[model samples]
Target: MELDEAIEKRRSIRGYTKDPVPKELIKELMEAARKAPSATNRQSWRFLIVQDDDMKNRLQEGITQHFVANAPLIIVCCLDRHAFTRQLIEKRVEELIDANVMSREVANMLYQRKLPQKVEETGIPVSAYLDLGIAVEHIVLKATSLGLGSCWVRMFDQERVSEILSLPLEITPVVLLPVGYPAENPSMRPRISMEEIILGFI
Candidate 1:
């Protein structure tokens, strides 16, 4: 499907069919997410795909949205807090410089700026959250293009989900994405006018 069509058709699908999503399509979705850009090229996002019935039931306990368990697959989108450490950020910047994607002078300037010295000191930054959101949106759009349905679910217990999935301390779950064949076709949700959204074009 065309990108524009996919964007227009995409919706927060709350209902899904019993049929399972194909593995190949799932891989495509993951590939799209993998290619998403991140701040300073810190590809820090991680995804945990859950399909088992038992595990889905367990996950539903943490998620307030019960419809999430109905989907054939659940993607536990996460952020690797350790990736924000000065060491890792410097490494990524070096790679960018080597690839000529970023100038050495710019990289040096970035290094001079204050950043988290250790992983332990790295709290989840807002940019990291935005990065993960971009990746998740990639997945959602890919799903729509592939004739699948998905929803971005955040109304859930993050700590409980981490415990249920046995996630490492560094891997923090940020969003839950449920994917499958659509059982309901929802109309487009209301949006603010373009004029309202575009405050001023400088």
Candidate 2:
């Protein structure tokens, strides 16, 4: 299917059939997501495929939307704990000194002090969240093109879901996606016109 067709046809599927989605299709969706761009080329997003029924029920228990339990599979998108960002910042700071753009003392000071505070003070950095978003949408749109249905589950309890999945301290769950063969045919919702959406530039 064409990209525009997939975009227009994509809907939030709340109800799903009992048919199982093939693993090959899931892999294709992940491949599409793997191509998503990230800040500093730091791919800080990790995907956890949840097919265990017990774990899915535990996740659904924390959600008010019971329909999520009906999905044959749920994907947990996670954020990296700034390990790579910290390393990148360090490397760039040193490079700045090597290029004579910054003094060694100044680079050391920034690396020793300010850099450590960024990940801690910022807590779940927005840039990482933004990066994860690009990857997540790739999977969603790819699923649409492949004749599968998916719904983004963002309202679930973050801590609870994290515990249910046994995620590490460095990995934080950002969003959940329920996937299956859609049972309901939802109508397209309205969208703001381009004129209202865009402020100035074409």
Candidate 3:
């Protein structure tokens, strides 16, 4: 499907059919996420594909929005601090080389050398969470193309989700994505006009 068509057709479907989403289809959606551009190609996002009933319920407990647990699949998007640190280091090194301050070999060495120390210091920044938004959008667009449905949700408790998923240290939950066969046929929500949104340089 054309990108614009996918964007227009995609909707936040809260109601879903009980029909199970094929594992392969879910894999394909995630594959699209894996290809999304990340900051410095750090690819800091990690996903937890949650389908089990009990676990899904547990993770949804702290979420004020009850529809999140109703879907057949919930993709928990997490950001890896270590990965973001590596990305920052690589990006900084590249900027230095591009500015003619460091040779190619020197830049590569510097990226590798400083990564571990940065990881020890700051781990990762909240800005890396933006990468998860990009990845989730890719998955959502792909899902729409394949006649699947999803909703990007944010009304959940972070600490509760961390406990429910048993996420490792330094992996922070960023967003929740519910995917399945949609039951509702919601009309497209109103959007701001391009003229209202875009600012001219003049």
Candidate 4:
């Protein structure tokens, strides 16, 4: 499908058909997401595709979001804190030096003293969350191209999701995507005009 058509047609769907999404389709979606660019190319994102009824129910129980439990497939997007932190540290190091916050000599000494601690801080998951957001956009667009319906939901309980999924200490869950065939056909919703969206070009 053309990118414009896919973008125009894609909508956040709440209702879904009873038919299950095939595993191969899920694989293709992830493959497309794998190609999305990341900040400093950190690629610190991972996904847990959940189809188990019990697990989905458990997640839904903790989350107040109404639509999350109804879909046939729920994908949990996770951020790898370690990877994002490494990228952030590398990106910021030169900036610190360039700004003259530290001399090269002092920077080198500070790097040796603080780099590890900085890396540790990066594993907090916000970086991974950014990575996951990009990946999720890729997945949603790909799904639209494939005539599948998906909704990016942010209404789940973080602690419950983390415990239910047994997510590692360094990883954080960002968003949940419920995937299936649409049960309702929705007309295009209103959107801001391009003139209203864009600013002066300078």
Candidate 5:
């Protein structure tokens, strides 16, 4: 399917069939996510695919939306906090410099910027969240292109989910994506006019 078609057809699928999503298709979605760009090329996104009934039930306890458990698969999208540490940021910058994608002067300038010195900081960096968001959107669009349906779910207990998944301290769950065959065909949601969305073209 064409990219524009997929974008138009995509919806927040709240209902799904019982049929399981194929493993190959799941791999394809992950591949699309793998190619997404990230801040400083840290590539800090991580995904945990859950399909087991027991695991799904456990996850449902934390998620307010029970429909998520009905899907055959749920992708736990996460961000690796360690990726934002000063050390890793420097490493990624150096790699860009070596590849000629970034100049030594720019790398030096980046080092001068203030960054999280420790990975254990209470608040995750906004850039880390943006990186994960891009990767997750890749998965969402790829799922649509592959004749599957998905929903981006964020109304959940983060700490509870982290415990249920046994995620390490460095890994933080950001979003939950439920994927399967659509059981309901929802009409397109309302949108603001293009003029309203685009303030001004400089």
Candidate 6:
């Protein structure tokens, strides 16, 4: 499907059909996430599929939105805790320079920029969260392209959900995705005019 069509058609579906989403289709949707780009190629996002009935009920315990439990599958997106460490980014820079992926001058310029520190001052999980966002979007869009419906949900208890999943020490669950066949076709919502949103794009 065309990217434009997918973007337009994709919506937060609160209702879902009882039709079971095949494992093969789920794998295809996740392939998009696996191929998503990450900072310095760290691939810090871990995708967990939760389909067992007992576990799904456990996930919905802390969440108020009961519709989430209706989804045929839930994608638990976890971000690695150390994705923004200076050492790992520096190693990537060295690799890029040595492998001729980028010019040494460019790499040195990046190293001297200290972008991560600036982001840290603002308390943003920059590299890692940004990467996680891309992966989550990929999953949703891919689901849309393949005639599946998905919703990006965050209205859940992070601690409880993480504990239920038995996530590792450094892996943090950032978003929940519920994927299944849509029970309703929601019309596209409004968007700001380009004139208002675009700020002097070159």
TM-score of 3: 0.84
lDDT for 174 (candidate 2): 84
lDDT for position 158 in model 4:
82
Q: Model 3: runs farther than 4 Å from truth? A: 86-120
Query: Is candidate 3 or 6 superior in lDDT?
Result: 3
Ranking by lDDT: 1, 5, 3, 6, 2, 4
- Candidate RMSDs in Å, in order, are 1.2, 4.7, 4.1, 5.6, 1.5, 3.8
Q: Across residues 1-202, which tens digit of lDDT does each residue of candidate 4 receive? A: 9999999999998899989998889999999889987754557778899999888888877678767788999988887666645445555556766776646786466446433344456435355566678899999999988889999888878888899889887777888899999998898878899999899698
- Candidate achieving the largest TM-score: 1
Per-residue alpha-carbon lDDT of model 3 for 108-135, expressed as tens digits?
A: 6655654554555656555576778899
Best by lDDT: 1
Each candidate's TM vs. the true structure? 0.96, 0.82, 0.84, 0.81, 0.94, 0.83
RMSD of 4: 5.6
Misplaced by over 4 Å in model 4 are: 85-114, 117-120, 123-128
Q: Lowest-lDDT window of 10 residues in candidate 1? A: 117-126
> lDDT by residue for model 2 over 1-202, one digit each (tens)?
8999999999999999988889999899889888997754557788999888888778876676888877998888898666455666667566666777778777667656544434543356578788899999999999999999999888888887788778877788888888999899999978889989889975
Task: Summarize candidate 6's per-residue lDDT along 1-202 as a digit string, tens digits.
Answer: 9999999899988889989899899889889998998766667788889888898888888677998877888888888655555665677678877887878888778778654533233223677788889989999999999999989899888888888788866677888898999999989778889899889967
lDDT of every predicted structure (CA atoms): 0.94, 0.81, 0.82, 0.80, 0.92, 0.82
Local lDDT at 186 for model 3: 92
- Candidate 3 yields a Cα-based lDDT of 0.82
> lDDT tens digits, residues 1-202, model 1?
9999999999999999999998999999999999999999999999999999999999988999899988999999999988999999999999999899999889989989888987778898798889999999999999999999999999999999999999988899999999999999999999999999998989
Clash totals, every prediction: 0, 0, 0, 1, 0, 0
lDDT for position 192 in model 1: 91
